[model samples]
Target: MQSISELLKFLTGTVFAAMPRDMLRELVLPHGHVALLSRRRADMIISRVRMVAGLFAVLTPLWIVIDLLVFSWPVTGLLVAGRLVTTVAFGMLAVSFRKSIRMREAYKALAMMFGIPTLFFIYSHPLLSHFDMAGPAAAIAAGYAFLPFVMIAGLAVFPLTATESAVFAMPVLCAEALVALLQLDMLNWSSHLGAFWLLFLIATVAALAGMSQLSFMMSLVRQATHDGLTGCFSRTSGEELLDIQFHIASRSGAPLSVVFLDIDNFKKVNDTYGHDAGDRVLRTMTEKLRSNLRSGDVLLRWGGEEFVILLPNASGATATSAVTRLRDIGLGTRPDGDPVTASFGIAERIADGVTDWHQLVEIADQRMYEAKMAGKNRLVGCADPIQYEAVVNA
Candidate 1:
């Protein structure tokens, strides 16, 4: 009995080991995979729609030929039925595509609704009475369903935790199992095996092309909008964000604050400690500022050794306090024991005044210079224009 139990345990372990790595991965690790799958699924659906549109363009004419030459009357009637069914399916898919574009439905929901149902319709067609037609249809369905599973499995190549791999892989494994069952039940196993393989090959090629394009586009967007050094928004991008915030604040009559920060004696640091140390100090200071700021606040690397913070729905007092906190944090030491300090200029948009985004930036920049002139490590500029001038003069 002990030997039999041990044998059973070993058999179970071997069976699990024999299973596809993707199936195992989804079962083990899932959130990042799920998010990634969700995005990819949405993209796949859009691509599928385009492919289907092209297919329909070609098939519509071929469908006419099949109706005229092959089927005669009853088959022609069935052909009409199939065409109608396909038309309705394409229409529904079009609607789903529009919704996906608008982000109205999750990709999983769209796939379940449009993708799965379309597969069912394709499998159920009577016009696929011919071996050639039936083979291609089955292949297409298998490829469509199986490709998602394959892509989901590729997530294992990423550095996911065990639990995450399991969780993500489970849904994908289920999807693959469903496809396998679909292949067994829906396909004309004897005649169209070649078509099934062809479809799988096509699906793989198409998915690779689609994902490659998406990755390139995402990389371009990141490079254009984000800073190379600190991974925050670039100065221009930050200004665009400020324009958005300014519009929102103007519409709501809420105050928007701009904080300009310049590293105190940053040139001196580069001269004394070297440029590498200066870079380290800037990186450390930005990280500190990011940690201290509120979630709503936007931080940007606004030129060399300078950063800009945009605070929406913040009054002059609140802006001053926040900048003061950031100022204190920026003046702290780096990991290599290099001391760093920053001077900040805080300015809030005047209510019902001619306060454009550029003007606000100008005011903040002027005040930041004032803070630097006064001392190396202080927060300044909470006073009215008249008082600000008086203080500057004093």
Candidate 2:
């Protein structure tokens, strides 16, 4: 039985690791796990917002129908009509958002998109004035049905962090209970307090469970996509990022540049000193390169002694200039005072061209080989792979 449980856990973790990148990046970690995460890590905020909006779009209208049928709608005709119209409109907008996502509009649109439904959820009790006639006991019982809805809503949030869930739930419960106390005269103010507190406790527990699920997803994603050695992106994740940026650049007619770099005589270092020294050199070089990159640039540990860089909206010449600076500041020297340096090759996507991301990487890689042949510690950047000169820049 214990073995079976362990196997199940492993499988569950594998499934989480295979989930979408856009979804995983926004997940919150457990308490004391904050040290394991980078708060400044870039998130696919637009993609996540679209996913959330798409879910609510499908859910809100269905909720409208359910409320009208299950709850007393006749006495709340105007409120029902308004809510139905609002939900349908939100659904329509969400459908449009799905087709082509754009930035700068994400935060505002997502705010309005989520804000409308949340406000409706809060004021729903006031809208259902008939709950007063249903008696306090019946009204309170019906309110409990919303617990499932609340849990479902947590999915839209993705990572319902520990305190975050309560932060969102408290207001809705308090508003509902307060409104119920006012409408259902049979429930005294004190009676409403007990209901509110009870629901708060229940919702917090459910929300925390939801958050734990998200944290589990994060752990798997981090393990699968991040390189354990240098804490850089794994090659698989790097490829995904390249594809995403390629499509973006294709649409915008922006240049997408890729650079392939190799540490000069890395094997010599390992054979001469030790594997531990080689690892230290890799970590140090990775940090130096990473710090000098622009905010949007991506760095990947392509393999041992090799790294790949993606520079969106940069041309080959522009990228060459940037990497030359890196060569200038390359690992100054090893523990034994031997000089450390790296070689680079750069390629850029031409506008309205037929080249693919893989092709671009290949071109850069070929130039990297040329750099190795041209006496090492140099860089090559050109549209033609074979024609690029492995110029000594360091």
Where in model 2 is the C-alpha error above 4 Å? Answer: 1-128, 131-157, 160-186, 189-216, 351-354, 384-394
Q: How accurate is candidate 1 locally (lDDT)?
A: 0.58
Using all chains and alpha carbons, the TM-scores for the candidates as numbered come to: 0.53, 0.62
Error of 1 at 354 (Å): 7.1
Residue range 1-394, candidate 1, lDDT tens digits: 5865575466445434534454454323333232223344456555555455445545544555545554445545665666666666655555555446212243333343334334433443323434343444445423433444344434322333344334434454444344444554345554345444444443333333333333333445557778988877898777767776787788898888888888877888788879888787877777888889887788889899988988888887888777655554445574456566677787888732446899888888887888778765666765652112212223
| C-alpha positional error of residue 196 in candidate 1 after TM-score superposition, expressed in Å | 15
Compare the candidates by TM-score and give the number of the best one. 2
RMSD of each candidate? Answer: 10.1, 8.9
In candidate 2, what are the lDDT values of residues 1-394, reduced to their tens digit? 5865575466445545645654443443333222123221113334565555667667656655555555564644655675676666666556554433333344345455545655665555454434454555356435643643453354334344545455556556655565665654345667666666656555644564555565565676678778988878889888877777888788898899999988888898899899998888888778888888997788888999899999989987788788877766665566577767777888888822536789888888888888889877778776644333223332
Clashes of each: 20, 0
Pairing residues by index, what is the TM-score of model 2? 0.62
